[model samples]
Target: MIKFLSALIFSLLIPLSASAAEYSDGNGYTTIKTPVRTSDPNKIEVTEIFWYGCPHCYSLEPLVQAWKKDLPSDVDFKYLPAVFGRGWLAHAKAFYVADLLGMEDKIRADLFNAIHVERRNLNSEDALARFFADYGVNEDDFRKQYDSFAVNSRLSQADAKIRAYGARGVPGIIVNGKYLVSAESANGNENIFKVVDFLIEQERQK
Candidate 1:
C-alpha cells in the first residue's frame, strides 16, 4: 500500500514539474555581465540590433511594431543597426540620415522593401541619394547629413554599443543591457519578443 501511494504522488508531481519547466533561465536567453547603462533612468531600454538588408530583420519589423504598441510605459524601444563588417556602414549611414531629415519612420520599412522586396542595390551612396530624392530630399541635403560630423558621431556611438552588447548577428534584442535574445536562443523571430517581455519583467524586479 505504501508503494501504491508513492506511485500516485509521483504521478501528480510529474505534471507540475513539466509545467514549471517551460520557463527557464538559460534555455531561452542568456544573461550578460555588467548591465549596459540605459539612457533613461526611469525607463527600461530595449534595443533591437538589426540590419536593413537582412530579410529576417525585415520580417520581424511588423511584429515588433505591433508588440511595441502594447509595451508598458516604462519600456523604451530603440533600434541599433548592426554593422558587422565592411559594406554595412552604408545602411548604418542611411539610418541616421533618415533620422536627421525627420523621415526615419517613413523610410525605415520602405528601405527594407526596397532591398529585399524590390531587389534594389541600395548599398552605395549614389543609390541611396537617389532613393532619398524620391522622398523629396534633394541630393545635396541627403549627402550633407550622410557625411556630417553629427551623423558620424552617432554611428561611432552605435558601433561602440554594438561591440559592448556582444551582438552576434542581426535581429538581436537586448533588454536593459542584461539579457540577449536572438532567433537562435529564442527559437524563432516569433518568440523573440516573448523572451523580451520576460526580460523586461525580470529587470523590473531589480
Candidate 2:
C-alpha cells in the first residue's frame, strides 16, 4: 500500500506536459540581466528576435503569428531580426526594408518560404532586389529603403538589444524586456508562447 501511494504521489508531482510545466527563472525562462528597453513605456512588450535562415525560427514563426493575433490590448508585440554577423545582415536588411515600405506582412512568409522551402539564395543585394520586385518593390526602391538611415538605425539597435539580453540563439523571445524564452528554456518551440504568456501575466501583475 505504501509503495503504491508513493508511486501515485510521484506521478502527481510530475508536470503533465511541457506546456503544463511550472515556469520559473532559470527553468522555463530566465530574467534578462541587463533588461533591455522596450518599445513602449506603458505597455508590456514581447519581442521575437529571429533569423530567417534559422530552421527553428521557421518552425516557430507560424506559432508566433497565430499566438499574436489575440494578444491583450495592453500587450505590444514586434519582430526584431537577429544580426549575428555579416552573413545574417542581408536577411536582417531585407526585414527592415520590407518594414520601412510597410510590406513586411506581404513578404514575411513568402520570403521565409523562398529560403527554407525553395532553397533560394537571397543573401545578396541583387537577389533581394529581384525578390522584392516581385512583391512590387522595385530594385531602386528596395535599395534606397534598404540603406535608409532609419532602417540602418533599427538594425544597429536590434544588434544591441540581443546582446543586452545575452541571447545566444535565434528565435529568442523577450517579454517586457525582463524575461527571455528560448527553445531550450521552454523545452521546445511549442511551449515558448506558453512561457511568454506566463511572463506577460507576471509583468501585468507588477
Model 1: lowest-lDDT 10 consecutive positions = 19-28
User: Which prediction has the highest lDDT against the true structure?
Assistant: 2
lDDT of each: 0.88, 0.89
- 42 Cα displacement, candidate 2 (Å): 1.5
How does model 1 fare in lDDT?
Answer: 0.88
Cα lDDT of model 2 by residue, 42-115, tens digit: 99999998998998999998999899889899999999899876668999999999888888988889989999
RMSD of 2: 4.1
Per-candidate Cα RMSD to the true structure, in Å, reads 3.1, 4.1
Q: Residue-wise lDDT of candidate 1 within 1-206, one digit each (tens)?
A: 99999999999999988754554657778777667888998999999998898888999999888998898999999999878867788999999999888899999888999999999999999999999999999999889998999999999999888888877788889998778898889998899887888778867888
**Candidate 1: lDDT of 116?**
93
TM-score of 1: 0.89
lDDT of candidate 2 at residue 4, scale 0 to 100: 100
